[model samples]
Target: MSQITISNAKKIYHDTPVIENLNVTIPDGTLFTLLGPSGCGKTTLLRMIAGFNSIEGGDFFFGENRINQMEPSKRNIGMVFQNYAIFPHLTVKENVAFGLKQRKLSKQELEERVDKYLKLMQIDQFRDRKPENLSGGQQQRVALARALAISPDVLLMDEPLSNLDAKLRIDMRQAIKEIQKEVGITTVYVTHDQEEAMAISDQIAVMYLGEIQQIGKPKELYHRPSNEFVATFIGRTNMIPAQLLHKDGQAYIRLSDGHMIAYPALNHLEDQDVRISVRPEEFVRSVDGPIQATIKDSTYLGLNTEYIVETGFAGRIQVTEESTLDEDFGPGDIIRLEINAQKMNVFSADGKVNLLEVI
Candidate 1:
């Protein structure tokens, strides 16, 4: 396993900067995910680490060794592409043995290594089958086994589960995480799927445009987001417009419908406009709650019922409640919504400053 470090990395395309002054340290033997929307330079950064792209500036290091100019084959990194790039003509065992054969290992050692990885990936039963005869998940396992047969110092995956169905994607993500833990190889995964990143990553770097917005554990980023962009991007949030008011050394946010909600008396900027971020699950249906709303829509999602409520304070807020067969709410039904103060986040009107910082 190797600790990967990137400092002041820059990438340019036709003089336009795609990745600018990027710096991140991926710990050894940890699954670090680079998460962002499309064209956010995540794949670009991954390719740069794999020596597939040239760095415009800065250094890329693997555990104190400078590899800025090293060839891709010399990087000792195993890469799993999105489409499971396996040879159509080669059987599973043959494909897994390709890397070992390239290194000119002895016949016994090569066969042993290939067999070990085939079993490790749970594709041993289909070792004699070609790619055409295997399922998508099976093909993915073969690709992973091939990558791991050589025992690389680092494993890089670029949306490796994107091609699978929803159920298969979930199952394969768990398998990938388990295999990564067992192998203990330094892994760098790039994906735009927020749920996948949160489910499998040890640490996630949320990127936007060409910059990293925040880096933290999944729970930390989801619960205590630093800004509006981080809060909205990480999960579903209702951005409610509010005004900060100060009264006798206390700071509170006044809603549009004349509701005054006491907040942490941290940054007391009187008469300043702010936006409050509330998660869907943070609102509760109460009889005497402070905020009043009417249900606009309801979606029954097996375990939980999602309601879109039209509130007087905010325009439309989504609330998720645990489903109870006895209680049913429909559109136009009046309901009271109460916010969980501890779980709420307040940001500047421009969505740059996290007001909780002063708390």
Candidate 2:
């Protein structure tokens, strides 16, 4: 019942507009993430949704109730901040029970609710301990437990896992996905980490320069980004300058390396300058491939090997492939490569529009 709908949202800071004419809807009981770089206004939009920031000119609603002017406390939202904002002075049980007690729940109800969430978040063993005594992961669990103990319609998390260690961050992200599914609360999460957003989000809204650039599932964003910014921002991609040519009623792209490849989809467009977005994995190291390059260096990670290669026409570009026991191409080793045109993206010269139709 907590499907969030935003319409023509606007936010301004000191007469400078931070967000303008934004519209998005978050489905009920789904984990929606706002993802972008630090200064892209993801946090600003999140604050607007939580009723902490005044909406300059827009309608914000949870379900059918307009909450644009409502008090933050009255909006029935549970927010877990980046700092793990649990009280250091209070024990875990008291911290979990704090929100319930604010609603004037009876003693038995508050105690049961506290125990339930403490058990749900698996932090019951630390019930009698204060925040200062808990590790970062444990403290984060306490914060999540306290937030859920209130049984709010919506949960807002702003970089909740950023403080945990690398391993704990992975563990906690899985825990959050499971817990969110169990509770079925409509949650809006905000983070700058693309991998974290891909791991946990049901749908992600990628923002930039005070505007939402794209919104889609993780795979959709990765495979079929709407523009140059979205394609580059969501994952690692090499932008290669290329030329679009139509010959014999067929479409072909001449890459910077002077290697031309046919892409049937581009036949409709006129011959012009274009940019090709190639992910590292899209490059195949074929013995007879057209493009020739010399490897400048190689980093052999366990699963894959990444190479920085210098090409005659394309300058230096990155390529990734699976590590093989017998193949070890070192610095100065020449290799031939080809792009997987079926999977590659072609964009306008200005990088504003992706030429390939969404499949």
Candidate 3:
């Protein structure tokens, strides 16, 4: 296991900046995810760490060693790509032993390492099968085994499970998580899938347009987002235009709907146009509340029913409730909506100030 530190790293593509003055520290033995939409430089950043791409500016280091000048093979990093990248003609055992062969290991040592990783990944039974004869999940396991057989200090995965079916992806995610924990290798995984990142990462960095918007644990990013982009991108949220009414000693700000919402104040300014971000699961359907809304639509998502409520004061608010949310409100049903004041977040119109910062 090793710690990775990137300081003021920048990258460019044809005069266009891909990463801008980026700085991030991935803790040793932790699974850190770089998450964002496509063209956000996540893959570019991963390539930089893997030594597949050059560092245009700043420094990249693994522990105390400066690795920017190192070759990809010398970086001691295992990479699992989106494509399985398995040899069609080679059996699983041969594929896993490829790296060991590169090091010129003796036959006995090669066989020992190959058998170890195959059993570790639970694909030993497929040792004699070629890539064409294995399932997608089995193929992914073989690819992982091949990467691990190299015994790299850090593992880099670039959307390794993107090619699998949803169910297989889930199973593979669990398998990967277990393997990572068992081996205790520091891992850097890049993916556009928010759920996958949230599921396995010890820390997640939300990137946008070559810049990191926020980096924190999944729950922190979800519950207390630093900006509108992080709040909207991390999970489902109802962003409503609101006016800063006033503040108390506790930094409680009133909204345009004449409701006082208590939250951590980010700035000292009294009056400003603020956008309040409330998660869909934070609203409660009520008979009498500060605001009245009409149910515009409802969606049953098995575990929960999502309500699109059109408020007279606040546009459309998405309210998510468990299937047992007591009462059901169909379309056109006039209902009172209750917002959880403590659980809501407020940000500037540009979505910079975290409401938690003010109070």
> Which RMSD values do the candidates have, in order?
1.3, 1.3, 1.9
Candidate 3, run of 10 with poorest lDDT: 245-254
The Cα error of candidate 3 at residue 270, in Å, is 2.3
TM-score, cand. 2 vs. native: 0.98
How many pairs in model 2 have backbone atoms within 3 A of each other, for residues 3 or more apart or on separate chains, i.e. clashes? 0
Native-to-model Cα distance after best TM-score fit, residue 153 in candidate 3, in Å: 1.1
Order of quality (lDDT): 2, 1, 3
Task: Give stretches of model 2 more than 4 Å off.
Answer: none
Model 2 deviation from the true structure expressed as Cα RMSD, one decimal place: 1.3
- lDDT for model 1: 0.92
For model 3, give the RMSD to the true fold: 1.9
- The local distance difference test score of each candidate is 0.92, 0.92, 0.88
Residue 59's lDDT in candidate 2: 96
Q: Write the per-residue lDDT of candidate 2 for residues 306-335, one digit (tens) a residue.
A: 999988766778999999999999999999
How far does residue 309 in candidate 1 sit from its true spot (Å)?
A: 0.8
Local error of candidate 2 at residue 177 (angstroms): 0.9
TM-score per candidate, chains pooled: 0.97, 0.98, 0.95
